[model samples]
Target: MSSPEQWTHPEPGEGPAARAAQPSPEQVIAGLRATTEGGAELTQLLTPEGERVASPQFDRYVADIDGEALRGLYRDMVLVRRADREANAMQRQGQLGIWVPLLGQEAAQIGSGRALRKQDMAFPSYREHGVAYARGIDFRELMGIFRCTDHGNWDFKAHGFHPYTIVIGNQVLNATGYAMGQKFEGKVGDEDGEATIVYFGDGATSQGDVHEGFVWSAVYDAPLVFFCQNNQWAISEPTERQSRLPLYQRARGYGFPGIRVDGNDVLACLAVTRWALDECRHGNGPVLIEAFTYRMDAHTTTDDPTRYRLSDELEAWKLKDPIERVRAYLARNGHADQPYFDRIQAEADQFAADLREFTFNMPEPPPERVFANVYAEPSAALDAQREEYLAYLSGFATAGER
Candidate 1:
């Protein structure tokens, strides 16, 4: 990671020579007004006050989702938020060495996750806790890696969710390759269908692998959706440091449609994700969705936001709280009651307790366990190495034990 000073800064007035020559004060003022009043439609279907806004692209898709379905989406956000908070608490309590909190991005993950079909495959980066929850993965399983007790406790093949990829943008390539494989396997546009969704953060977008993934997807016309969660900060580095233009525009350069959606709005996320997946399934090639969101917590348990950010900014984002917005919507529309909210809280608490118990009792893998899976077939050299390691451990025992 580079120091803040080393990061790029957008030159406010350093573009085309013709425009730079002379801009009257009046022209500059007009330009600023136009920018503020008219730009792109940063797609949003849900407001911070929980009112449903009109979005032509998504309105038709969400029209059939009844009140019950809306409530279910709200529930998903609540439970996922609880699990996220518990994970953070556990990390702080020393139960785990580290944690990456998905504190404010529940709507983005849940919306995208719920939109995914059973046949769809998801490739996630490390911070996608909500994505894991939506995919039916036990929250405890996620803790295993951070706790250093296990290597991917869940079955990736069974769940259609890849194990969390820690390397910044590597999963982008993996996802593209997987989608390309799907194309080769004649899985594209089949009546029996599937598509791939790859998740990465704004920080990852700066990596070469992410760009390569986009190029490959475009060249192959692979069925993949590159979901970029622009969570404002990438471990203290703002999105501006990574790119001058919005991340979504990068996709357009690669010959695919790029969209910027309000990631904090669950309805928009689901609607957009569903459309992207359908486009891929129908062999429309790749799509990129820039989910404009904010990471409300520290980058991870080890991170201290105080060093680089302001509390006032965080407080501002709180007003756009993803879970609270949905709850407000539910309450205002009479889709949910006090009992419903209470039950959701209770369920969340139970889940946290269960996770605590499971993590506490997680068995440590034996010393020899490390050697067990080193190779598919044991070699003579490996057998000798294992024997030497055993002897080394034996040499440190008490006299009687030895």
Candidate 2:
């Protein structure tokens, strides 16, 4: 809750020297186990059991989410999860180098993703397939990334979704700078103002680049939303190992308001993100949202989560599955029936089928393609190197033909 104007040096013996009380190891473990329940500050509009919960402040943001809109959100999560699972399976089948599964965090990604305006930009860490889908990026366009065939070739300007950043929290720096540029260009402080949202995992908070981004964005009042999906683990490390306090609270020290949300609840994610984006567009700027969710799969296809965690934890999270809650709500309210659910499942299956077919048919890029876009402007040196490489390749082909 602290702001930049609130900063003042503490008196001697009243700051860090006071030695705040640290929680015992047992207390830490208890706290970690209880995070699944989402603490009191969490902004939630839907319960795990599919019941609707009202929030006086956030409800107005999602007041337009009638049955049709709710159904659309449900469909988004279903298709995204289906594509993610298919990608994961393809990796095991040797179709891709590796895959980052977005299995349990669908609501977190899709809800926040759908909340963005067309003018808003998004920067993502590698595991944001759901967000990409919501941004209108073809699922097939992403296949090349995991297959190691193409660096993302999508039109970022048109889609407002940047390329996936693989180096942990590196995208945070990129987004912060971009948001700063938005401020510099006088693109903020109006209803039509632009904002940027950067997505990273809970583990990324440990990286220095993320902290630097927080400081820079805060200082400039840049229109950026720091969306942290706290899926409970950074590969093998639990959340407790990452930070003593809930990650959202860290925003206070950086002079911004941070809020925790029930990441498993799509309605909550949408409402909170819309609110954050509204604030940024109006120049309040640089809010942080910690999405309390879980990751049900290995960090990547290459990771073996079984070596570090137990099945019991996975089972506990399964009961809170993001998709099922929406499905339940739809059915219980008669907004959708079994036939509707069946049609959606069929569509998701077809989506996966298309993705698989695309991967199977993907052609290898020519060697020269690597040098094609190294620079925006022409470079004689790069052109000369490309010609040399192509000539080398041609020599081998001619020898084979002979």
Candidate 3:
């Protein structure tokens, strides 16, 4: 039996009926809802209706979190949502190439993000905007990559965050290697030792690189946390297509523990992540967390979800909106008032405006910028491409003179 503190992860029921039943494309509209013998498959701290529930194991981790911390978490979620909304709007206005919106995953990102110690590093996939926010990354610097101006102008080491990795599951290898390096440097098995956290989506798990990363991390007992946001869809493909069992179960095969948490429940995410990171620092690492959540928007601004996913499904998830539940919890418990909520909205508006202004005024990258890192000594191919680009640009200028 599982402890009250550690909510039991319900296994898929066995038998002929279970074997005969497979969720079809039509059933994808079922909103990815699954239940366990214990009630739900996920460990939840807050319900969809804004009610706070007790979890002994997770609650022990967050015992010190008071009303102020709860309010701060709410504020973080609000600001992140605002920034994401602004980014989407900017993309639609042609100010950006594309945006991978983290619309419904704010709790998943922010809660886990805040759990990291200063020495810990986080490796992000393309859509960890909320995590970037939690790291105190200047929103201005983060937008440069999407602006087509600079390839992430922020300092990776200082922020303890690497540049967003676009390749599927590639960053998992990078994070694993970094964690191994930390172990080599004798940074493991201590409260002050560094740890590594890597973010990858459900889709990325299908890639061999992620599998290899799992093997390496487990074998070495690297101080690492694999935070997988199972947002139902890996782009257009549902997570149903990616695994024979729940994504969390994969951790067992690698000789580590895995748990599923309600991604929308920020308190659970924070407590769970804190415990996991501590476990890593104490040398019981390479833990996997499957944050079960839904993506409320299209994969990117360029994609339309309507063609594949059902509207009803999106509506169903909306009731479980991460921000709303946090807000309600705050209000119901008298942790925050209406005036405070208003102020947050006002602040979010200002943030969006400021973000928009800076984004619009962002300077274009010079042609030479692309070839800057081609070689320590300039390569012939790079020089040729640079010269050709300059020549082509000049031709347009010359034509204007005529």
TM-scores of all predicted structures: 0.87, 0.93, 0.87
Please identify model 2 stretches exceeding 4 Å from their true place: 1-25
Task: Tell me the RMSD of model 3 versus the true structure.
Answer: 4.5
Give the winner by lDDT: 1 or 3: 3
Q: Rate the local accuracy (lDDT) of all candidates.
A: 0.82, 0.90, 0.86
lDDT of 1 by residue, 21-105 (tens): 2444444343333222212547888888999898777888678777899888888888888878887888878889888889889
As a TM-score, model 2 comes out at 0.93
Model 2 residue 37 lDDT?
Answer: 69
Query: In model 1, which residue pairs have backbone atoms overlapping below 3 Å?
Result: none
| CA-RMSD of model 1 | 5.5
Write the residue-wise lDDT of candidate 3 on 134-241 in tens digits.
Answer: 987988787888886777867688889998999999999999999999988899888888899999999999999999999999999999999999888888987656
Winning model by lDDT: 2
Ten-residue stretch with the least lDDT total in model 2: 1-10
Q: Using lDDT as the measure, what is the rank order of every candidate, best first?
A: 2, 3, 1
Pairs in steric clash, model 2: none
